[model samples]
Target: MSLFRKPQPITVIALRDAPDLVTSLRRALETATDAERPGLERALALTEDVAERPDAELRGRWVRRHLDAAGYEGPADSVNAIRVLRQAEPGLTLLQALTYARETAAAENTPL
Candidate 1:
C-alpha cells in the first residue's frame, strides 16, 4: 500500500441548507465571482479548504483573517461584523449581503 492520502471532493450544500459555518462560509464565498472577490477572498477560500482537514489552529488563523479583511479593524467593528453576518436574510448572495451589510454599517459607524 502507498503512504500518500487520497483527495476527496468537499461536500457542498445549498446556501439555504447549509447547517453550519463550513457550509455557510463555503456558500458565501461560492457566490463571490472571480472579479468580485473582495478583501478576504483568500481567508474565505482557506477556511473552506480546512473544513475537511479540520485543524483548529489553522482554521482559527483563516477565520481571523476573514474577519480582519472585512474591515473589522477593532473590537467594536468585529462585533458588528458578527451581528451583520448573522442576519441571514433570504435570496441574497454573500456579495449582495455584504453590500447591505456595508450600508447598515455606515449608519452604525462600522464597515462591513
Candidate 2:
C-alpha cells in the first residue's frame, strides 16, 4: 500500500453557497479541540465576510485577503501573483496557491 494518500480535488463552490459552508464549518468547530479552533474560526469569518460583500471578483478578493493576512503588503503585486498562480494551477486550493506564490515571490525578491 502507498504511504501517502492522493491529493483530493478541491471544489470551487459559488459564493451564494456560503451559508451552507458556514454552517458546516460551525458544526466542525463545535467538536474541534482547541488546536483546531483558530484555523476553523478564521475560515468561518472569511466565509461570512465574503458572503456579505457582493463582489463580482470574489476569488480575487479572497486571494488578496489571504495575502494580506500573510503579511504580503504589495496590493498590485499580490493580485498579479495570485492571478498567475490560478492560471497555472487552477486546481490549487487557496492555501496551496498562496503558499507556493509566497515562496516564489520571496525567492524572486519580489512582493506578493
Task: Give me the candidate number with maximum lDDT.
Answer: 2
lDDT of 1 at 18: 18
Give Cα distance to truth, residue 105, candidate 1, Å.
Answer: 22
Output candidate 1 Cα RMSD.
Answer: 18.5
Report the error of model 1 at residue 44, Å. 26
Per-residue lDDT of model 2, residues 31-68, tens digit only: 99999999999999999896685432454455555556
- Estimate the overall C-alpha local distance difference test score of candidate 2: 0.64
Best by TM-score: 2
Summarize candidate 1's per-residue lDDT along 70-102 as a digit string, tens digits: 655543234465443434233444444344344
Evaluated at residue 74, the lDDT of candidate 2 is: 65
